[model samples]
Target: MAEVAAITEREIELISRFVVLLKDEQDALKRADPSVLQEIGAEKIGLAEQLNTLEADRRLALGITDDQNTREAMAGWLAQHPEESTAAVNWEKLLELSREAKQLHELNAGLVAMHLQLASDALTILTRQSEQHHALYGSDGQAAPVSGSRIVDSA
Candidate 1:
C-alpha cells in the first residue's frame, strides 16, 4: 500500500484546471460528430507526450526516478545519446496539432450549444402538448389535435 505523495499547490491548481478543461471538452464532445472527437483525441495524445516530457524532467530533478520506469528514463538517455536516436520532436507538428485541437474544441462547443437549444425547444413543445392534452382529454395520457409554432424564449 504505497501512498502517492501529495502534489504541490501549483501542481494541484494546474491539475484542477486540466480536469475542468477535460470535462468541458468531454461535454462539448458529446454533441459533436464522431470525426470531431476522433481528431481532437488524436491531437490530445501528442499534447500528452509534450506534457510527459515536462513530468519526466520534474521527476528527475526531484531524484524520484525509479529503475522500473525504463521508458520514463529513456527521455533523459535520449538527450545524452542524440546520435543514437532516430525519432525527433517536431515542434511545428505539435503546434499544428494544438491548433487543430483548439479548432475542434471550438466546433464542439458550438455543436453542444445547438443541441442544448434543440433539446430545450423539444421539451417546451412537449410541455405545451401535454398541457393541451390535459385540457382536451381531461387528465389521463392522450393527444390533442392542435398545432402552432411556439417560441420558448423571446430573443
Candidate 2:
C-alpha cells in the first residue's frame, strides 16, 4: 500500500506559533527582571510541554509515530504470516524526514538570530538617544548657576 502523506493547516499553525512563543520566552528570560524570572520560567516550561504534545499528535496523525513499536509489531506479523512477508521498511524515507526536520530547525534558528539582531539594534539606538539627552540636558537640563562643578560617575 502507498504511504499516506498529509499535514493539517492547524498543525502547521500550531507548530509555527510554538516556535514564535518559544523564541519570545528565551528572549524574555534573558531580559526579564530578576523578580519575575520564576514566572517566565514556568510559562516557558508549560509552553514547551504544549508544543511537544502538539508535535506528537501531528506525528501520530501522519502515521509515522512510534518507530520502534511499529518495527516490533511488523516483525511479529511477518513471522506469523510467512507468505505475506515483505522486506524491512526502507529507512531512506526516515532519513529524508530527518533532513527535512533539520532544515526546519535551521530556519527557526535563523529567525531567532534575526530577532536578536533587531532587538540589539533597537537597544543601541535607545542608548545613544538617552546619552544625547543626558549630555545636552546638563543634568535635568539645569544650567549651573555662576560657577559650579558637575560630577559624573564612571560606574
Candidate 3:
C-alpha cells in the first residue's frame, strides 16, 4: 500500500512535469520555431517513456495484471485502503494532467498541419507563376510572347 502511494505520488510529479513540457511545446508551435519544437519533441518522447514505466510500476504495486481493468483495480485499491487519501488525490490529479497533455498534443498537431498546408499553397502558387513566366520567355533570354507576334520576324 505504501509502495502504491509512493508510486502514485511519483506519477503525479512526472505528469505535472509533462504538462509543463506540453505548454512549452504549444508555445514553440505558436512561434513556428522548428529548432525549439524539435528539442521539445525529443524531451516529450523521453518523458512519455518514463511515464509508461511508472504506470507499469504503479500497476504492479497494486497487484493488477496487465489484462485487468486498471481503473477498476485502482478504484478497488483506493476503496480498501482509505488511509491513502493522498494517493487518491494524486491519482485524480494525474488523470487531469494526462487529459491536458493530450489536448495540447492535439492542438500542436493541428498547428503543424496548418503550417504544412500554408507551405504547400505557397509552393503551388510559385510553381504556377514560374510556369507562366517560362511560357512567355525562351531559354535564350528571349521573349517568346504567346500573342504570335515577333520583334524580328525575318532575322
Candidate 4:
C-alpha cells in the first residue's frame, strides 16, 4: 500500500511537470520563437518518455496489463482505501491536465500548418511572377513561358 501511494505521488508530480511543459510549448508557439520551440520540443519529448516509463511501472504495480484494465484496477484500489481521497483527486487532476495538453498540442499544430501554407503561397506567388510572361526567344524565334519552380504541387 505504501508503494502504491508512492506511485500515485510520483504520477501526480510527473503530470504536474507535463502540464508546465505544455504551457511553455504554448507560449513558444504563440510567440513564434523557433529556438524556444525547439528547446521546448526536446524537453517535451523527454518528459513524455519519463511519463511513459512511470505509466508502465504504475500499470505493473497495479497488476494491469492493458489500458482497459486501468480504471478497474484503480477502482479496486480506491474501494480498498476509501480514506485515500487525495489519490482520487490527484488522478482526476492529472486527467484534466492531460486533456488540456492535448488540446494545446492540436492548437499548436494548426498554427504551424497555417504558417507553412502562408510560406508556400508566398513562394508560389514569387515563382509565378518570375516565370509568367517572361518569354525567351527559342531557336525558331518563338516566345515561351519559363518553367516556374513551385513550392506547392499543382496536382
Best by TM-score: 3
Model 4 pairs whose backbones collide: none
Tens digits of lDDT, candidate 3, 18-134: 888888877877887777877877887898898899989988889889999888999999999999988899888878888888898899889899989989999999898766643
- TM-score of model number 3: 0.81
List residue ranges in candidate 2 displaced over 4 A: 1-90, 136-155
Specify the poorest-scoring 10-residue window by lDDT in model 1.
1-10
Model 4 Cα RMSD, Å?
6.6
lDDT of each: 0.49, 0.48, 0.83, 0.74
Q: Compared with the true structure, what per-residue lDDT tens digits does model 1 show for residues 39-154? A: 55665565556556655654554356555353344445445556532222332233344465567567666776777898899999989866763343313566443444334111
lDDT of 1: 0.49
List residue ranges in candidate 3 displaced over 4 A.
133-155
lDDT of 4 at 59: 80
TM-score of 2: 0.34
- After superposing candidate 1, which stretches have Cα over 4 Å from the reference? 1-89, 133-155
- The CA lDDT at 13 in model 3 is 83
Residues 49-115, candidate 4: write the lDDT tens digits: 8888877887887777875577678878778887878777766766777787788778878888877
Clashing residue pairs in candidate 3 (N, C-alpha, C atoms within 3 angstroms)? none
Clashes of 2: 1
